[model samples]
Target: MCKHILNAQVSIRAPCCKQWYDCAECHGESQTHPLAKTAEMAFICKKCKKAFRKNMSEYEESDEYCPHCDNHYVIEAKTPQAIVGVEGEDARVDNRMLKDDRVKQSTNRSLFTINSDDLTDKVG
Candidate 1:
């Protein structure tokens, strides 16, 4: 349940602390020290819950996925954004913030329009 990367498919095992984190930002926030760089990075796949290692030097496009579950772990991180409107707000609270600008459909009908029988008789 990472707030930084909502769609993160794998947890990276920080080489320095040997702790799992969804992203570098998460590691930075939880730990006092900066994330350590390593040529061979370890990752735990969220889908299969398996651990695997990848050598950065020999990394390939196929290495982007988990070897156990074949789940694509490498993807563009989806970060939270600041919205100006009620687009991301909860539905219950949105009513208070949004104005009802939609035009109301008229329910009023003329006598002639309502009495279709009379209009049909006149046309016939």
Candidate 2:
């Protein structure tokens, strides 16, 4: 409580956001485009504390690689991972289909004349 109150009283400084620029081809030699490269990246690792680009840059351009394990890592921009939970429900339409002696067509109309296994039975 006391720490929160003290923090609130102190002026908090917001971090500066970086602006990115196009590649060297877009602003080469005589070109005077502002900031052809970004100041810093957004996503950073806690263990390494190094900034890493999240965009679809080449593996060589990435700075988030694990030095200890030499593992390449990329952070996705568009979609994050999703977690789904399955609920208990009756998923089977009819178990009798498997027990049927005659092979039925998938469309439920008529079986095709194609030479196939399991659909034809031999009578001894």
TM-score of each: 0.68, 0.22
Q: Rate the local accuracy (lDDT) of all candidates.
A: 0.86, 0.36
- Tens-place lDDT per residue, model 2, 1-124, is 1222221111111122132212222223324444333333344333454444433243355445644343444333232346796554444854543445797667533345544554554333
- RMSD of candidates 1 onward, in order: 10.2, 17.2
lDDT by residue (tens digit), candidate 1, 1-124: 8999889999999999999998999999999999989999999999999999999999999999899989998889888897785355776866676678999976654554646544643432
Regions more than 4 Å wrong, model 2: 1-37, 46-64, 75-86, 92-124
User: Which model scores highest in lDDT?
Assistant: 1
Leading candidate by TM-score:
1
User: In candidate 1, what residue range of length 10 has the lowest lDDT sum?
Assistant: 115-124
Report RMSD for candidate 2. Answer: 17.2
What is the clash count of model 1?
Answer: 0
